[model samples]
Target: MAERIRTLTGHLVRHTGKKSPDVQNVSGNLSPAVQSSFRYTLENPLKTLTKNQRNFYEENGYLVIKYLVPVSALQSYRKRFAEICNGECTVPGLTVMKDVALAKSSPIQGEKAVVKIQDFQYDDALFQYCCLPQIIRYVENFTGPNIMAMHTMLINKPPDLGKKTSRHPVHQDLHYFPFRPADRIVCSWTAMEKVHRQNGCLVVVPGSHQGDLKPHSYPKWEGGVNKMYHGITNFDPTLPMVHLEMDPGDTVFFHPLLIHGSGTNRTDSFRKAISCHYASTDCHFIDIAGTSQENLAEEVIDLAVKRTGLPREDIQFKDIWTLKSRCVKGEQNHLQGY
Candidate 1:
């Protein structure tokens, strides 16, 4: 059955204009030959990235492209976010989350109070970011022609309210994912404004993607940690970190295993960015139980129970991801199993 699935997936990729030689079998454990063929970076010809750019990503686990998004489009997204916060618009399946510090303190209303919005695939305006031609062009280089936008977020890093709760803990993105062949997944984060250290820009450890997924849990901080904000328990503090200060429309595409986090927003305003995690439709979900991802999966299931008032047994972790994922390009093959 597994071999049959791979054959069908390979045929699908060929029909979609992607070279079959670049396709990997999506079933069972990857053999050494397959693993060697699908390196951290693609060896085949790229659609948008130059050879130097591809080499940079291979060595550093990330690549930054300046002015990859239009300022006008970002402004439009900002307006839509404000409308959603002000209760002027409703988007089904969207989650509006407030900063943990602000949630405890005096209630500040509107967009300023909300820290981020998740699962915005149902919102046409914001979801357009995932389908941007410029983005997909680069994304196809990493995830191939058949792609699925597995996750979406518009982060609003609110100014710290003296508690330093606005800072996200350093962790790997794969900690929250239950997918295999981690090389097939990539995240594109675009700044919605000028982001600097003072305003909590992204801090990344270069070449971290070559490492294995580390164990993670909530960091112990005086200010309460936000729901689902897990941190690497054994993160090597001595490892060199780079602060990614980006202007509006500057975008970075990174591997899932890259260790990264942001500083507190010391500035008085919000630091905003939009991002989507894309994976090859050829990638398949894995059982996360008894693994480092188990804790997060349990938390997500618990949250689902509270939100939907459903029986705990009915809401599996994979089901949550299956419902959230949407195909951005080509056929949705292996990833659709719920």
Candidate 2:
């Protein structure tokens, strides 16, 4: 445990937006380095989680479980968040609603956020919240102890403000991240309250991780910016879209490539969630500059683009972390290799 903490501290000091391995997997194209890391991650996944975790990721691309954060932690976090927002506590580098991008220079297409804090050190709640034994167990069950906090933020959907809501554009986490050994990376989406439909519950296109990555535009929120899934309409209309109505402590594990977005917060209460991404120590970076990997690797098959049982263009993996997930007429999906 001490070694993991020490290594992660080193990683944190050197951390940038992307920290994947040099040989990474982006929709089945394998750089030799990524292949080795993939093998290592596979061999020790059970060491971090039970057999159930491996099965969970294989079937669902993520694990939606709990105990990642405790109720007391949430309460303390909520108070601190409020204090910062209200200007009662002032941090030298923190940004609040006052720093929102002015309407005169509105950079995005929707209502701006009320607060955006960057480089938020989790000394108070985040450390304890993220390092919980249950949470560590789940991660250990997969990637061993080589983990670091990628990023943190606060996106408050205050009902009184009636923030204009729209889909946050669908795209894989790898598109913007582009790290090596992409397969070892994981994300945890934890909620701060009851995330209901009216309160902007996150909607996910389950199993969409098996297909191609679509084009997208990112928006600047708080003090940070990230990719948003929009402009790409290449999904199977038949597959059921799922909305995760999560509670305060529940979190959703998902592949970075899954298709997901949230609706407007029409309800009276606030709905918020913290999404943190982690990866194994050996994740690699790829050499996409000169490989046939420009298109989805031949091994990473997409049911929609292949048109095996139906139309050929039905499935496709157009972007970095894409897959052909929509199979036809009760056909079984066997993700061969990527």
Candidate 3:
């Protein structure tokens, strides 16, 4: 146990530049169960990931698997997206959000005006992507057998309108999640079309998931930031970053704490991607009352109250998540906190 403590201490010091008081306390109180859950572990005998792939994910916090999704699936999703946007179909509980810049100005009609749709778990066609056997196989490796699709989105990054409102600020996904043992959570993001730097493909800080979740706030960009598009306040600009340029049907599975964002779409077309955040059913909700996430929780609760016409006192951050999440694999367990 002394050797283990030393190793953890060294890692903490190296990443943080000094040993944190919280780490010191945790080291002294470390338990075997807690230590085991400190990071993601590959299943013995392995399910879908090769040893090298598992190692890469452990070291880099993300793995890009080319052609994990098929072209046919991507086409179907695109068709369904257009149908929804064109008002040919309505997806109950799905929130269609327009680009802030376009919404402020003369809004484009039909599908072009919509920038994204969130919580589409109710839409069977789009939800099918979450249940693809290949995706579930990879997701089980990170989240174990029992999985819950905690959040879902089909991001349509519209072309920049002079203002760079299309650019997403660098932030950790965990900042918006109220959950414990973040290692059990992973996000699967697949490109619907060829994505490159010009179209604002994903930009990730390699291995940034090894650090703790930082405080987040809306960036003071001259162009108005999107609602709930919070950014890491202290992200080091000098950190080496990788731009993930992917072809259609390519998917990347990344840790929730990995710091990532995309650039503004400089092309005339929209950059589209489908993503879902999955977590182990064993993971439980966490209270954000005294943490950096409190601000986000409050904002989310307020938005829920306004949208549903529910009393502010009756809405809770966890309740909102519970309503949005659905079991994609295995049996639903702890995440149902209403």
- Tell me how many clashing residue pairs each candidate has: 0, 37, 0
Best of the two (2, 3) by lDDT = 3
Write the number of the candidate with greater TM-score, choosing between 1 and 2. Answer: 1
lDDT of each: 0.83, 0.48, 0.81
Cα RMSD (Å) between model 2 and the true structure?
14.3
Compute the lDDT for candidate 1: 0.83
Q: How much is the lDDT of residue 294 in candidate 2?
A: 31
Better of 1 and 3 by lDDT: 1
* TM-scores for candidates 1 onward, in order: 0.88, 0.60, 0.88
Considering summed lDDT, which 10 consecutive residues are worst modelled in model 3? 18-27
Give me the displacement of residue 268 in model 3, in angstroms: 0.5
Model 3 local distance difference test score: 0.81
Off by over 4 Å in 3: 1-38, 44-46
